[model samples]
Target: MNARLPERQASRALLIGSSRFSHEGLHDLPATVNNVRALADALTDPALGGLDPSGCRVLTDPTTPQQVGDAIDGVVNEALDTLLVYYSGHGMLNQRGELFLAVETTDPDPRRVHYFGVPMGWLRSALADSPARNRILILDCCFSGHATQAMSGTAPAVSGNLDIHGTYTLASAPAHETAVAPVGAQFTAFTGELLRTLRQGVPDGGELLTLGDIYPALTRALLASGMPRPQRLGTGMADHIALARNRAYRPATPSTVKPRTVSEPRGTTITPGVRSTNEQDPKVAAEFHAAMLDGYRRAKKELNYNAGNFIQMVQQVGGLEAARRLLRASSVSSGFTTLWEKGRLDLAVEAVVLQDRFAGLFSDEELDIARDRLAEYGYSPAQTS
Candidate 1:
């Protein structure tokens, strides 16, 4: 069966990552903090997870179990379709071998684990009680595989009470294994791989990436890298839920340009990847350069565009070609769609590039793409006024 994407409007996500710990026994995991922030960005990205930013709550280094519990309760109550809860950091097992999620103030002493750490049973209870039709739990930490066991009613922690219907659990490691976190890495081993999978996307996978598609790939990649093999448990159609858009997906109609190698005045080879800055016709490049700067300013002032890489790209590729590249994209560029979603596509650089005055600069196929994308969004050239 084909996986279905969750309703972006009705789904909610809660991301919790404990990066710092007060007790010296529980070493700090700096990568966990970056994991939460980066995962949040990837999930809310317009072209990726497509989740509303407001619906995805991120908690880093939570102070208390109540804080995390309340957040989970809030999302569980609000979400009518799907509820996703992701936790990355330390996972501790008390004297009874029950799993507890460690927080900033959690004590390594198993006796006091209940005081600060959040119990795995609490999550099972919340999921079992939630009205949402789909529930997804992702854990990235030591002994995370115990979560799968807990959900299956085989674990001593929440024995015989794992009645979480329509729930899916993805764990970073087996119950007895400790998840790897390499020193100086930006994110933990499991979460870093997850982020990479989400961003780089599966080249041969379907347009929408489901749990079934991701888990196998993650397992192969992690095991190949000498990391612990991840585990998964899914009930009902939970495995068929789509989590992200395939970044490597191609449209039916191709818009790729085969570049012709050109030599500069000094015999420097300009390949497809090398963009010309100063060698191009000054007049043509200057016109587009001016338009680009104007639109950049307008987008920043009006649409709150804060992407720093955009300016860097303009400088590297030169404004004239940069505008043309956006126009030639098979689908609307994410940056342009971001502006359109902000209710200010009229001020976008793509809009300026598509103007009649600059029509001659771009090919007919390229112009068609730019116009089609705007029209798809119900945007008109007259909207510029």
Candidate 2:
């Protein structure tokens, strides 16, 4: 029998990623930013993890341990069924052989690390004390396997006794090995595979995905890719807990399956680097219009705008129509910089219009305008599209 999905209202997840570090020795990891955001989206997706948006919290480039600790405690206090904590960044080992997760302000020096870095022992204690029945810790960083070493009895005595009763710990690499963050990639290699597994799902699998289902798959995929094999430590029924709905599940009746024609046009031939001009079916068009409006509203709130200029444009012309007009304009829009500053250039009308799923909805010229405008703001077609 497959494991059960966590109840949406009773579960909480905290996703933390640090891309930039203040210490001179730690190089920036631009991909970590994308990792957290994409994972948050996947976890909160209605058809995937089914977690409520409010329950999935994301912290990018957190500066201090207290900030992360507070966020973790906040969720741990609220979660009744499941509590998941994920971290992606540099993992450091101090002189005493204790593992620490590097934050933006973390110093590499052994003495200073104790004060700046977030200790893995702290997380162990929190998980041990958490009231949630199911606890999960996924660490994607160098030396992350040390976090689970306590379970094997090779770690410090204090850490060995700190293992939680009902927890599943998944580390990206072995204790001494460094995790891969491929150059120019959208995510760290380990997390990229994790996201791919969630998005693509296991073929011919059960209705829901359990840790038992995902762990072996990840091991095989990572080894085949020549990446480091992951390490997992599960206590009690942790492996039986479902994390996501299987996307690849098929029913007995073929006719009952909905065709995926809405997201990708069936007969349309689109050119490379250019959007197709084909008109969509009414249902598809209506959905695209709604998404455009929704994206606009989110951008307004994210930008914290009180001025009605952009809102008026969107209201009068409709979001998609306004996007069409914006794409055709020669000058960059005023809101582009602010959106970019907030790491939400994706919310900009120009970027939103270029989504891959909306490939056939816009013309080549209009798409070019969107692409060019985004290029001026430092987004390449690969990043925007």
Tens digits of per-residue lDDT, candidate 2, 114-137, equal 789999877777777888888999
**Residue 50 error, candidate 1, Å:** 1.5
Candidate 1, residue 243: Cα displacement in angstroms equals: 0.6
What lDDT tens digits, residue by residue, belong to model 1 across residues 148-215? 88887877555465555468899999899999999999999999999899898865456777776677
Deviating ranges (above 4 Å) for candidate 1: 161-165, 250-385
lDDT of 2 at 3: 68
Candidate 1 lands at a TM-score of 0.64
The RMSD (Cα, Å) of candidate 1 is 19.1
Per-candidate total of colliding backbone pairs: 0, 0
lDDT of each: 0.77, 0.77
